[model samples]
Target: MTLNLFSQFASPYLLGVPLIFVASISPWLLLPSPANRWMPNRLIAIQTWFSKTFTKQIFSPIGPLGHKWALILTSLMAFLLTINLLGLLPYTFTPTTQLSMNLGMAIPFWLATVLIGFRNQPTASLGHFLPEGTPTPLIPILIIIETISLFIRPMALGVRLTANLTAGHLLIQLISTATLALLFSSPLVSSLTFITLLLLTILEIAVAMIQAYVFILLLSLYLQENT
Candidate 1:
């Protein structure tokens, strides 16, 4: 449980970065058509018939944008959540618990927000940073605050994810160490520690899902606000 910078750097954490990158961005490359334009009605029909016949087939309830978006978001979530959970396993590292990896994901998302907003509404997107109805004296302060808030999005996103994953991992490690230490020192204490670690493992699974949900929810909210 001693913090070892070199140990972390030497682990497979670095490799997860590219894996996550590919998982997040590969869908765009594979699916060349715009989400809005890509229709799978024929495919859907085939799937629906299969579902009806087998009673164990898959069905897509949403349109192309919704489905593609779901796939993209799920891919991201899977990579990050898997990385986060990996730390629980012996000899594995969680890349998402690292600041660099979290920032890599967050910064791109922030840039995506800006690019999407501007692309959707070239002139009006500026209005998001500077609202129309504002008091004359307060305009400067509002603009400054808005600008700061805009910049803080990525910072918040990165810090929130990294902090959550890091804290969870640290807590698990602490409990695990405590359990090991107590095994020789006190059986009762060791048993309690084991129980706590078990409970925490379950909680971490929920945390993974919650974190994924939060990231995608906030992302969608940002998109909705701008567009």
Candidate 2:
């Protein structure tokens, strides 16, 4: 029974093709494209406004040099936001819940910031490893510790996203299963559980949005430091 519950996380296959691949890319189609008319429809307009607002907020802390990432970062935010929200619907798979996929995204973006730091300011980048005025005795140990922390950033990003979504989904599943089991035994308790499920679902929606924003916001901060 526990295995059955976790089976939901397994990638579905059809004729030996992974459907998760399709699910990952499907969100792109949901995004509105530019209209031929001078005035776009409401959907396009809303998308534009949201993108602009998010871009401004995210990049404001970053210097002008970091603004170059606005397009890719904004698109990533939209993609993640759409995927997370869509996954909340019944019978849908969330790609972000997979550590592999999350890491795939986190590593590249994180590496880009690190590489930018190395390219633009190599001294500052290496200086991050060893602080000023450190005693000679502890210098090597601090460098090792700081280096480990630096490398851990991408893993943290990926695990944080995967863990949050996984926990939320698991809780929802457990509560929902209990609710269904109690439905035939005690309608009152079942109804209360259902109410709790409803509230949890709403909270998950907010979490979905917030997680996406946080991912990008952290990336922007990394860029800010490098710039």
Name the best candidate (by TM-score).
Answer: 2
- Give the Cα lDDT of each candidate: 0.64, 0.92
For candidate 2, write residues 26-60 as lDDT tens digits.
99988978889999999999999998998888888
* Candidate 1 lDDT, 122-217, residue by residue in tens: 788778667888889988898899989988998888888877876777777778878998998899989988999999989987887677557766
Task: Using lDDT, give the best candidate's number.
Answer: 2
Q: Candidate 1 local accuracy as lDDT?
A: 0.64
Which window of 10 residues has the lowest lDDT sum in candidate 1?
Answer: 54-63
Task: Go through the candidates in order and give the C-alpha RMSD of each one to the true structure.
Answer: 8.0, 0.9
In order of appearance, the predictions have TM-scores of 0.70, 0.98
State the TM-score for model 2: 0.98
Worst 10 residues of 2 by lDDT: 4-13
